[model samples]
Target: MAPVPLTVPRRALDIVVALALLVLLSPLLLFLTVLVRTTSGRPTVFRQQRMGEGAREFTLYKFRTMRPDATGPGLTSGSDPRVTGTGRLLRRFALDELPQLFNVLRGDMTLVGPRPEPAELARRFPPEYQWMFRHRPGLTGPCQLHSRSHAALLNGMPDPEEYYLSVMVPRRAAMNAELLAHITLTTVVRYLARTLWYLLSAAWDRSGGSSGRPGGDATRRTEEGRSLCVRS
Candidate 1:
């Protein structure tokens, strides 16, 4: 398949929205930085290398939620012991990922797209899955949307690494490919709106309120899985 051209309009939207959010959320970002520093110690921001557009590698940033010498394999299972107290909270709300706005600003990522995979992990994807990387990785997208509760799901699994690689990775990659193939302005807007609803609903659940449904807690449980992977 031919590579899709980089979406200039998408990049422009990413830049505008990221810049506006960075400016608007500056105070919260600063407070979170200080909190992470005091709670986790030095290196307020955690940087990890992720595979980016066209299979390039770039440094992805998040608030330091784990200790400097955190142990365990690459996959973070639910409630892994390495997470700091503040890190757990940050991961719960995805505050840790706010730093990636800079990555979006730098053109390494976008507000919505496939979440970037780690370089080594991404390399293991099936050959057909590679095409999903033609555009910048996103902070929110179909993979992220579907995996909202993955951390909780994988928590205490026999081997999170195995399951994530063998099961989750392929499924998410296929979903990403589908999203990429059908990408459009309307689709992007719909995805963005859905993400907002998830965040809001998750926050509402965390506040000890119900949305008047039988599976309300289940939804919250999934949102709690935000930290189950990289940030958890």
Candidate 2:
């Protein structure tokens, strides 16, 4: 696939909105920083190497939601022992990802694009899927939203990287390509609205005392020998 020409106007808008959001959310960011420090102890921010556009590597940021030494293989499960009580709350409310607004501001990410993958995981993707690398990774994208409720269940299982590479990546790539095909102000607004809705809905569910499913039956089926191939 040929690289899509990025629109300067849209990129400028993304930058402006990201910077504004960082400024507006400064107080909340500070509070979360203190909470993480008090709960997880030091290193309020978590940084990890993630594969970016054109297969370049970049450091991604997030609010620390695990013990300082929680690093290992694969993704995080909801029941992971490394997650602190505060961390669970942050994850539930998606507060753990707030720090990525900096990523958006820094040009390392976008408000909407394919979610970045760890370098090791990216290595497992086939060459065709690597086409996703043509665009900047995003803070909130199709795959992130799609997999939001299943992280814990998926992370706990063996070879979960297959789920991300085989299932999530293709779906995300399609959605991202669609987004690029129709990249416009209206689409961006709609994407922003959907992202906000998901966040607010998650917050409401948490406040209403709901235990969101760790994994859906469909996800289980995919894990249980079902093909993860995406239809063209």
Candidate 3:
């Protein structure tokens, strides 16, 4: 599939909104920084090498949401032990990702686009999956919300790079391409609203309410098995 060209107007809008969001959220960012420091013990921000448009490498930013030593390949199950108490709160509310606003301002990312994958994962995927490189990576995208479980499966797999390329990446790339084709200010606004709602809902559920467990453990386990297949 060919890369979709970004319209000039859309690009301009992206710049304007990204800059405005950074400025408007500065106080929130500061507050989060202090909270993370007190809770996670310094290094409030985490950076990782991620693939961007044209398969370029860039350092993606996020508020640290895992233990300082919790580095390695594994799926982040709801019950992952590595998630600190405050980290769980941050993840549930999506507050941990607030640092990526800087990525948008840096032009390495867009507010609405395909979420970038770690460069190692990108390298493992095939060329077709590489189509994701056609557009800037995003802080949030279609796949981010709808495919959380699938993403967890992919990320947890032994050869996730291959599974992502063979399965998830192609499908998500298509969705992202479609989104790019229909990009507009109204659509972007709607996407943001939906994403915010989803985050809030998840947070609400986590706060002593119903667990929005989308699938049964059996189903999740099946997906996990498939993830293992990519390696075998």
Candidate 4:
């Protein structure tokens, strides 16, 4: 199923929330933009094609974390060599994604929906998982909330891309489908609150490198997060 309709109310909420966020976070956004520009050189904001609703393609924006001239596999774990010091911190705390609020304002995305899959990754999804494209992609969702943990897992993988496509992709599709199938206002609210907490809490992690990989408190928190959104 495509989930209950949130067309009118959801779009309204997305606009109100997105605009508020953009305004409130403007200073930090400017700082990060300048930070990336100075360190990585021009084009501080990274733009790439991501799959949207109905498999349509649209440009997704984020602060550039990798070297501007980087030439490596597209799928990267946080620990990848191409990631800059600023890039690593931005990725760790998800400050790089603050620009995606613009994506929500533009109607290319929603505040809560499936994580926008890359075109290549979406193309490789199994037939059963194709239903995920029925809705616009999200700034945050079930899969997105635990992205840190997922990145941590990918860090330990010898072949991250292949493992992600083979294991993580299908798992995410199923989890996202389940949540969307029963989505509601409260579900959306919980997700947004949880996402904020997840992002803010990342600051407490003192890991010099790596995404605070799964272990001890990290594992517990990941499990707690997973349990939060998997329910109706």
Alpha carbon lDDT of each predicted model: 0.67, 0.65, 0.63, 0.71
Clashing pairs in 1: 78-155, 149-222, 151-228, 227-232
Per-residue alpha-carbon lDDT of model 2 for 122-226, expressed as tens digits? Answer: 777888878887778777766667555556446456766667567666666787787777767777777788888877787657442111222111121111122
Off by over 4 Å in 4: 1-6, 156-158, 208-232
- Candidate 3's error at 93, in angstroms? 1.3
Give the top-scoring candidate (TM-score).
4
- Model 1, runs deviating above 4 Å: 1-3, 206-232
- True-structure RMSD, every candidate: 7.5, 9.1, 8.4, 9.6
In order of appearance, the predictions have TM-scores of 0.82, 0.81, 0.77, 0.84
Candidates sorted by TM-score, descending order? Answer: 4, 1, 2, 3
**Candidate 4 lDDT, tens digit per residue, 13-110?**
89999999999999999899789877766656666667788778887777766665465444666566667787888878878788889999998899
Error of 1 at 4 (Å): 3.6
